[model samples]
Target: MLTTIVVIFLIVYLGMILGGLPFLQLDRTGVALLGAIALIGVGALSLEEAVAAVHLPTVILLFSFMVVSAQMRLGGFYDWVTHKLAALALGPAGLLGVLIVVVAALSAVFSNDIVCLAVAPVLIDACQKRRLAPTPYLLALACSANIGSAATLIGNPQNMLIGQTLGLSFDGYFLDAILPVSVGLLACWGLIAWQTRGRWTDGAALVPPAALHEARTEAIAFDAWQTTKGLAVAGALLVAFLVAPWPREHMALIGAGLLLMSRKLHSRKMLGLVDWELLILFMSLFVVNHALQRTGVTAHAIALLAAAGVHLDQLGSLFGVTFVLSNIVSNVPAVMLLLPLAHHPMAGTLLALVSTLAGNLLIVGSIANIIVVDAAARRHIDIDWRGYARVGVPVTVVTLAIAGIYLALRLHLATG
Candidate 1:
């Protein structure tokens, strides 16, 4: 039984790294779900035990935030903000700075992927109107979103997972991450601006008319009331998470329910916008990981590693492993795999920070990166791996270094 569990865990994680099973139609989510089902079918876990293994609080919190993001999208808040930012009379560098800051700030509060999806096309159009190049700005958007999302527990999926799983304080995590995330955002802006020095204009023709028209189809006109309501709910949730003793998931669910009761945006539309596949991925991985843990293999392996002087509970080892696994299997899955080892004092903060910032290493490393790239592609602006890496590589290296230094300082303060 232990061997079977180990085999299933290995295969599922391999699929995560490869993005799917070889020649199979299954994605990471599907692979994880199948692995969980296999364990149940083979009696490694009873149906009841599998269900119990899944963390409902984390799932609820994730779902509620998705609805909040969907509400903002349907209300055209994202589009309105992008347009406003474009209308500023700043120079190329100044505008790039503002874009990075705003994108990062919004992503810290909302879904980073949705922020890119809603803003990218309109941003492309805005750049064309200004005769400025969109590539640098688009890259800034992706990088800032990934970095900024590290600022808060709810900033991205992985942070949310770490926070909920470890029961970290929302305010504590925010305070610990603010410095690294802010420095990372500034570094991202500087690198992109320097790369595009004196070449803000591509002098290229506007995107194909058909592509522009298709992109515009997803835009929602700004609805002030809906936007205001969404903001109110988000603000209230943050306050609750920080101050109130209520369960975070319960409060988030109530906020989602309030948003659902909206008369203008139908609940079906909001629900449709939620990433059901991502929810499934989390649920399935929870069951699979729990079954594996029950078999004692994971604990035994960690003990062996500790004895060999490679302690994952230490900040340095955790940071290195997180950076590599995040780039390989993407941040969310990587977080799930390493979260069990997060028993050190600073482990949760380290995991949340590294897993998120690591996504800036590759275009495929994070959903936010994919969303920005795909959005650009739809507008005929190709951001191939090479083009992305030119910016992504530097941004990732600098940000990770900042995070490492910050974590090291915190560790020293704790030990000293």
Candidate 2:
């Protein structure tokens, strides 16, 4: 049983690293789900035990926020904002700065992936219309979204997992992360602006007329009432998470329910936007990891590493490992793997910041990056890995360094 569980764990994680098993037509979520089923079949864990392994608070919170973001998307709030921003009378660099700031701010509050998904196509069309090159702005959108989402615990899935698992304070995490995230956003803007210097216009727009027409058709008309309702719920939930003595998950779930009971938007539309695959990925990883923990393998591995002077509990060690693993298996699964060792005072904050910032390392590093790239591709714009790396690599290195220094300073001051 132990051996079976171990093999399943290894295979599932490998799938995570590669985005799927070779020639299997299975994605990370499918691999994880299958691993959990295998564990149950082999009696490594009972059905009840597998079910108990999933953290309901984290799942509920993630689901609730997905609904909220969907409401805003269906209301066309993101598209509306992009058009308004693009209509400004700013030069290329100034517009890039504004794009980074706005995307980061919106991502800090909403799901970064959703923000990118809704904004990228519209942004591309907007840029083409202005006779400005869309590539730099697109890269800025992806990098800034990753950095900005690091600002708050609710900004990304991994952060939500760490916060719920560690019982972290929403406001406290925000206070700890704001500086690094701000600096990282600025770094993204600088790197993108520098790379595309004086080259803001492509000779001819790459986007086809048909693609532009399709984008317009798919865009939702901005509905004031729906957008306002979503904003109200999000704001109230923020206040509740900070001040009220309530479970953050419960508060967010309540907010989602309120959004569902709307007359203008159908509940089906909002719920349809929820990434059920991601939720399943979380649940499946919980079971597989819990089974591995029961075998004492994780404990033994940690002990072995500690003996070799590779202690994960130390801030420096944790920061390095988080950065590496986040790029390898993507942030959410990487956070799940290392979360058990997060016992240090600043471990949660470090994990949240590094895991997220590291996603900017490559195109395959984060879902937001992939979403932006895909959106661009549909409009005949190609942001290949090399193109993305030209911006992604530097933004990642600089942002991670800044976060490391900030956290180290915070730790020093606390100890001093």
Candidate 3:
């Protein structure tokens, strides 16, 4: 049973690294779900045990935000915002700066993946319409979104998991994270602006103005009423997270319920935008990781590493491992595997910041990067791995260094 569980765990994480089982057509989510099912089938864990391994608070919090973001998408709020940003009388460099700030701000609140998915296509069309090369702006969007999501616990899935599991204070995390996140956004803007110093126009928008009318975004018109309603709920949820001692998940769930009662938007559309696959991935990883923990291998491995001077409970080790694992198996799964060792003084903050920021290392590092790449491809703008790494590598190095410095200072001051 132990061997079987180990093999399943290895295979599932391999799928995570490769993004799927080779030639099997199964994605990371499928691989994780199958691994859980295999564990149950082999009696490594009972049905009840498998069910209990799931962290419901994280799921509820993630789901509720998905609903809120969906409401924004349905109301065409993202598209509307992108249009407004593009319509500004700014030059390429100026536009990139504004875009970095705006995307980061929105992603800090609405989740980076949702921001990327909803904004990328529209952003591409906007750039093409302006005859600006979409690559730099696209890179900025991806990088800034990842950095910005590190600002708050509710900004990304892994952060939500860490916060709920560790019982982290939402407002407290925000106050600490704002500095690094801001530094990251600034670094993103600077690096991309420097990289694309000369080639800012694509000449693709040379097409007629009338042809440009067919923007790449969905036809969902902006509904001020729906947008205002969603924003109100999001604002209220933010305040509750800041002040109320309530369970963050329950408060978010209540907000989601209120959004579902909309007369203008149907329940189906609102619910449809929720990322069920991501939720399933989270649940599946929880079970697989729990099963592995039961085998005592994780503890044994940690002991071996500690003997070799690799203590993950220390901030430096935690930061380095998260930076590596997040790119390898992706951030969510990486966070799941390392959660047990998150006992350092600043482990929560370190885990959240490094895991999220390191996603900019490669295109496969984060779903937001992939979404942006795919959107650019649809518009005949190619952002290959080399293209992304050009911007991503520097952005990552600068942001991580800034965050490390800040956290180390905080730790030093607190301990002293």
Candidate 4:
């Protein structure tokens, strides 16, 4: 039974690393869900035990924010932001910088994958209309979104799980992440801009003004009142979550409730946009990881590491292992696997930063990357692995180094 569980778990997670089973229609979410069912069918995890494995707080928190982000999307908030950026009239370099900052800020507050989903197509069209090469801005959008999502406890699913499990304060975690995130955003801008420097002018000829004007004509129709209301509630909820003593999940739930009260936007439409598959993925991983723990493999591995004097609290090994594991299984699952042994003084900060930054290493390293890539592909704009690696490699290196140095400084100051 243990071996059956182990084999199924490995197959499922390996599918995750490859983004799907070989030549199979299943995606990461589907693979994980199937793995959970197999464990149940094999009697490795009883129904009650499976239920116990799921961390409801994390799920609730994630669902609530999805509602918030969906409200913003239905309100045309993301479209409005994209249109405003298109109208900036900046040159190639300046526009790249603007794209980096705007995408990063939005992703930090919202789901990076959703942000890319909503913004990438519009961004590509905008750049193509302006005769600006869309590749650089597209890369910037993908990479910066990943980097910025590392900045806050709720920025991404993994961070949400880490925060809840570790009881890390929202504001405290934000403070620790702010410097690394800011520097990482800046580094992303510089790296992408440098990579695309002269290519901007060498691309297609100027897009006629008429074409540019026509492209902006379909800029998503916005309901001004709805947009304002969503932004206000989201803002207030954010402040309350940071400042008030209430648990963040409860606070976000309240905020989501307020959004649903609107008469202008149908509650059903907003609710439908939530990524239920991702929530399922988290729940499934929880069960699988719990089963693995039951098999005593994790305990044995920990004992081996401990005997070799390897602990997550140590700066170099922690960062190194985090980088490798995150890119290996992707960040959320990797964080879940490592969270049990993350007992270092700054483990919370380290796990959040390292796992998040590690996503920038490969096209498959993060969902945000896949979101942007797939979105672009749908538009017939191909952003291949090599093209992404051009920016991802440097961005990962520089930003990770900054994160490590910043965490070490924090540890030094706290210890001193």
Candidate 5:
């Protein structure tokens, strides 16, 4: 049984790392679901036990936030922001700085993937209008969103899972993350600004505005009344999560219910955008990781690491391991694997921050990068790997440095 569980775990994770198994017709979500089913079939976990292994609070949190984001998406909020950013009549370098700061700030508040998806097409159009290269802005969109999402619990799915599972204080985690995120944004702007300095001086031939404008078929069909109502519910629920002393899951469910009370936007459509695959991914990983835990493999490995004086509690070691593993398997699974150790001193903050920031390391490192790249490709704006790495590599270095320094200083201050 133990061997079967371990083998399934390995295969599922391998699928995650490889972006789905070769010719297997299964993506990460399908791979994870199969792993969970395998565990139940082999009796490593009972059906009841598998259900129990899945964390409902994390799922609820993820679900509710997706609704909130969907509301904004439907309202054309992201599209509006990107257009505004593009319309700013700044030089190339100046526009690069503006784009970096704006993308980072929005991403800090919303899911990174959604932020990238919403912004990419408009940004591409905007760059074309300004007679500048869209590649730099698109890359900035991907990298900054990944970095900025590290700032808050709601910013990334992994952070949401970490925050809910560990019961980390929302305010406390934000306090820990804000400095690094702020500095990281500045660093992101600097790197992008330096790279685009010369290109802005000699503007590329402009693409027609009509061509870009025609791409937006889905207009912002916002009911101001409904949008305001959803925002109010979301804000109240956020406060409830932080301070009202209600269970986080219950508050989020209330918020979701309130959002569902709409006259125009059907709940069916809202629910469709919820990325059930991602929720399933989380559910499946929970079972897989829990099944692995039953084999005493996790505990044995931790004990060995502890005996060797390599505690995950240490800031340096924690950051190093998280950066490597997150880049390998993506941030969500990496968070699930390491979250068992989140009870260690300052571990929740470390886990959330490291898992998120590590996403900036490569093209496949974060879903946000993938979303932006894919969106651009759909519009015939090819942002290939080489184009991405121009911004990705430098952005990763600067942001991680800022995060590492901030974590080290906090640890020092806390210990002192």
Candidate 6:
């Protein structure tokens, strides 16, 4: 039984690293779901146990936010905002700085993945219109989004999971995180601006492919009423998360309900934008990890580490491991695996910050990065790993250092 569980765990994670199995059409989410099914089929977990293994609060909250984000997308708010930001009469460096700031702030409230998906295409068009190279700005969009999402508990999936599972105070986490996140955003803008110093536009800048945009029909007219409604709900939700004592999942669902009762936007359109695959990935990993935990393997592994004087519950050890594992199995699964060892005084904050920040290290590290890259590709703009790493490597290292120092200071203050 133990051998079977270990094999399944290894295969699922292997799939995560390779993005899919050889000769198979499965992605990370499919691989995880298959592992969960294998466990249940092997009687490692019963049907009831599998259902209970899924964390409903995290899933519910994630789904609710998807609905809210969908409303914003369908209302054309992201499109309107990106166009306005890109159209500002500023130099390349100044423009990149502005884009970085706005994208980060927007991502902190909505899911960073969704923020990238909705904003990427619009950003590409905007940059092309201004004869600017879309690559650097797109990289900044992904980098800053990852960094900014660490500022709040509800910013990204991994943060939301850490917050919900650890019972972290929403307002408290924000206060602990805002400083590092802010500095990280500044560093991101500076790095990208420096890297693309002289090459802001292409030689063919004056000639935009009118034929390319002529066939594009993705324009959604800005709906003032819908945009206003979505903004009001998002603002209210943030205030409640900060001050109210109610369960966050319940409050978020209430807000989603309000948005869904819209007169112009149909329920079908709103639901269509939800990333059900991501939710499945979350639930499936929960079941797979729970089954593994029940086998005592997790305890045995921890014992071996402790004996080696490498306790993961320590802030420094966990911080380093989170960076390595996050880029390995991706942040969501990495967080699920390390969550069992989150026992340090500030473990929740460290986990949330490190896991989210580590994503900027590589394109495949986060869904947000993938979304932006794919968007650029459709426009015939290639942003390969090397293209991304020129900026990503430095930005990631700088941001992580900033976060580590801030947390260390907080620890010192409390202990002293």
Instruction: For each candidate in the order shown, give its overall lDDT on alpha carbons.
Output: 0.92, 0.92, 0.91, 0.86, 0.81, 0.90
lDDT accuracy of residue 293 in candidate 3: 100
* Pairs of colliding residues, candidate 3: none
Better of 3 and 6 by lDDT: 3
lDDT of 4 by residue, 1-416 (tens): 87898898899889788878987899999999999999998899999999999999999999999999988888788888987898997888888888888888888889998899888868877777687877788888889898889989888999999999999988888889999999989888888778787798544454455545544653557778877877887788789977898888998898889899987788889999999999999999999999999999888887789789886556677788889989888898899988987788688889999999889988999888988888666555668999888889999999999998898788889999
lDDT of 6 by residue, 1-416 (tens): 99999999989989988998999999999999999999999999999999999999999999999998999989989888998998899998999999888988989999899889888888887887788888888999999999988999888999989999999999899999999999899989888888888999853253246535731566567899999999999999999998899999999999999999977899999999999999999999999999899999999998999999998989999999999999999999999999989988699999999999999998998999999998877777788999888888899999999999999999999999
lDDT for each residue of candidate 3 in 1-416, tens digit (9 for 90 to 100): 88999999999999999889987989999999999999999999999999999999999999999999999999889989999999999999999999999999899899799999989878877887788988888899999999999999999999999999999888889999999999778888888998888889854555444434545326468999999999999999999988898899999999999999988799999989999999999999999999999999999999999999999899989999999999999999999999989887579999999999999999999999999998777666778999899888988999999999999899989999
True-structure RMSD, every candidate: 1.1, 0.9, 1.6, 2.6, 2.1, 1.4
The number of clashing residue pairs in each candidate reads: 0, 0, 0, 0, 0, 0
- The alpha-carbon root-mean-square deviation between model 5 and the true structure, to one decimal in Å, is 2.1
* Per-model TM against the reference: 0.98, 0.99, 0.97, 0.94, 0.94, 0.97
lDDT, candidate 6, residue 17?
A: 89
Comparing candidate 5 with candidate 6, which one achieves the higher lDDT?
6
Segments of candidate 5 deviating more than 4 angstroms = 201-214, 218-223, 307-309
* lDDT for position 321 in model 1: 94
Estimate the overall C-alpha local distance difference test score of candidate 2. Answer: 0.92
What residue runs in model 1 are displaced by over 4 Å at the alpha carbon?
none
lDDT of 2 at 30: 97
Q: List where candidate 6 sits over 4 angstroms from the true fold.
A: 203-211
1-416 in candidate 5: lDDT tens per residue?
Answer: 77888999999999999989888899999999999999999899999999999999999988888887777777677777777777887777777778878887777766778778777877777677677777777888887888778888888899999888888888888888988888887888788778877676343455455645555664454456665775687678667767888777778777777777777788887887788899999999999999998899989998899899998756677778888899999989998888877656678888887788778777898989888888776666677788788788788877888777777887789889
Number of the top lDDT candidate: 2
How much is 257 displaced in model 1, in angstroms?
0.2
